[model samples]
Target: MRYAFALAAVLCASPALAQQPTAPAPGSNHDARPQFDISTGVDFERGDFGTGAQVDKIAIPLTAGVSIGSVRVSAQLPWVRVTAPANVIAPTGPLGLPILVDPTRPATRTTRQGLGDLRLGAAYDLPVQGIVASVRAAAKLPTASVDKGLGTGKADYSVGADVAKPLGAVTPYAGVTYTMAGDPEGFQLRNSFSGQAGAALRLGGSASAQLGYAYAQNPIEAGEDDQRIVGGLHADVGRSLSLGVYGSGGLSAGAPRLGGGVTLGLKFGR
Candidate 1:
């Protein structure tokens, strides 16, 4: 459950799916060159995750990235807070497997806060006819404290590919990922697969909206699979500033009942 929550936070903090780069606003001094980007945002989610007791989570993530030619690289680190039953241990990093201290033990309210795992990722844009496509890989470094239930104490990795094609004012895209879960001391986590499909609609020259659905296989054998509907609104404010607001609603007990967040991004260099 904690793993599910952490992953949800990471997903929510990200920009909308299928969003294509748009031209700078008219009269703006935006440079048409490869650039470095930085973004930060806060995300919140609440859910029972099939457990009888409710859990709440908050994450504030900082991310930075740069594009060079057809390749892009990025890093992200987040601060996370969790409040839940004592039996429900909270793991601070994304893609962690949920671990219950004692499923049979009576639960008590508990809270944990700390820095989360560090994530590093790289991607290569694939040249394709009439479509944007990319292949990506990411790794989660175990940085949080396992003793404090802030991480799995082991690393995780994932690889995926996505493609988007523009059709008039709408861009439709789909992606699939395979994650290798880390097995902790007493737990055997299962590798999982996740996928998303979405379309982004250009609202004008500077704004767009996206709607999507996502599904993930459960990393825990006894846990329910995760499913959700997601959407977002994004806008460019100036030559180098952008804003995004997004929301999600769970379609399964494995996901947050509802979640939302805002992100602000800045771009530098030409």
Candidate 2:
């Protein structure tokens, strides 16, 4: 559950991303090592999931991991803020499992914030010829308060694989993930299939840019299909620190009309 709230300013590229390159392009395959990072960002979106509602969300995620050969393992703790039309029943959870209040009941004005589901995940990388293949798996814990509209209060899981080929400084990649969210409370959620593909271009030694598209099937029976175009840039400020900003616009009625985020990274032992 990403591409949070949408606001005019959030859609504008940030000045922080205007630095020189000191590292590889963000999101490109790289050597693994023990590291820790904390990312925080704000997003504002409208007409999310065809709810005809406006939303503002702030998310903070912290991750720490180590690599063993080509394997990497990490854990993430996430917190979020959500403000939505009380009548639309915006349910939320981690990654692909979003929860909503029982819509059959009368809705009220809603604004809530707190922890999202905690997650532990791992990834493996395999290089074949000039193409690199990768697989990832994660498990979500029921950590958020369902009454606060922060989560579905159920455990969830997802697994996916993708391959990428580097063509000089420009690399293209594609991948898909299947999410399984168990039923919680009175609602039954369907398993979701989502996919993403795009290309990333590294600019000199200090900056990189990327463009991509994402598609996801709604987990709810009547939920609208989710489709959007997303892109962003990353800039290295120094040897170990970088800044990133991204934005997305929906291509379908079921998706958010607009959404975006910014992230700051400080890499160690990379």
Candidate 3:
């Protein structure tokens, strides 16, 4: 009977020994995999810009990536809609195109729809024990119409690092990023910095949840800083397939009041 009890204990703990639960955020190690992933989602946000003026954006975004060993690469393409007061940018076309005018335009509301910027990024995981860390970098290309107020017409650069530690079924992580933007006419956008901190819980063998906070400094001179609370979940639905859903609530005036996204992915390798 004693031998039987010992055998049962070892069998029950063996599965747990093979895998540790971790968070599901990109750039964090809690749920890192050496695989290819393709996902898509739509996101929307509304913000009050003061004086009864408001702005809104809706975006459909897609991302594709592959990770092999310690290195990962990805790309992004987005379709976006922007609605703002004409005082910001007046409409010159039927498809919601924005035409930046002199200081004399009317304050009527205008809307524009177009492709957004394209993005390419990569990350490399460091060789470390216990806590895992990665170097991250990305670039945003001018793919959207500048006259339509969809893209900056210039490239943006970003670099950052993220670190995470997994403890049993939970993981905690943090990261910081710095972005450099190109200057456009009438706007002197500054280089900016942002930070993220989060914890993730593994619900079972195939699902996980995370809660976190993100803060970013304003890149435009007239823009305010943004801080937000974020939460997300990830689950496996079938062989080589998964789903992710995430949302954010703004903590500062610079952010949209509410925002969320969903992603379905096909994964390989891992």
Which number leads on TM-score? 1
lDDT of 1 by residue, 5-109 (tens): 112335532212211222112111223356788988777778776676787877788889877667778888888887887666555444424434545434778
Off by over 4 Å in 1: 1-9, 12-34, 92-106
What's the lDDT for residue 162 in model 3? Answer: 72
Cα lDDT, all candidates: 0.65, 0.57, 0.56
Error of 3 at 246 (Å): 1.4
TM-scores of all predicted structures: 0.86, 0.82, 0.79
The residue-by-residue lDDT of candidate 2 on 1-270, one tens digit each, is 011111111111100111111122323334444554444444444555566555555555555565655677766665667776453334333345432546654465577778766677777876556567777776778786767766667787877776766688987766677878768877888888777677778788777777777676777878776677777777778877768777777787666676666766665665
Candidate 2 overall lDDT versus native: 0.57
TM-score of 3: 0.79
Ranking by lDDT: 1, 2, 3
Candidate 1 whole-model C-alpha lDDT, 0 to 1: 0.65
Off by over 4 Å in 2: 1-38, 86-94, 98-101
For model 3, what is the error of residue 133's alpha carbon versus the real structure, in angstroms, after optimal superposition? Answer: 0.9
Which parts of model 3 are misplaced by more than 4 Å?
1-34, 49-52, 87-106
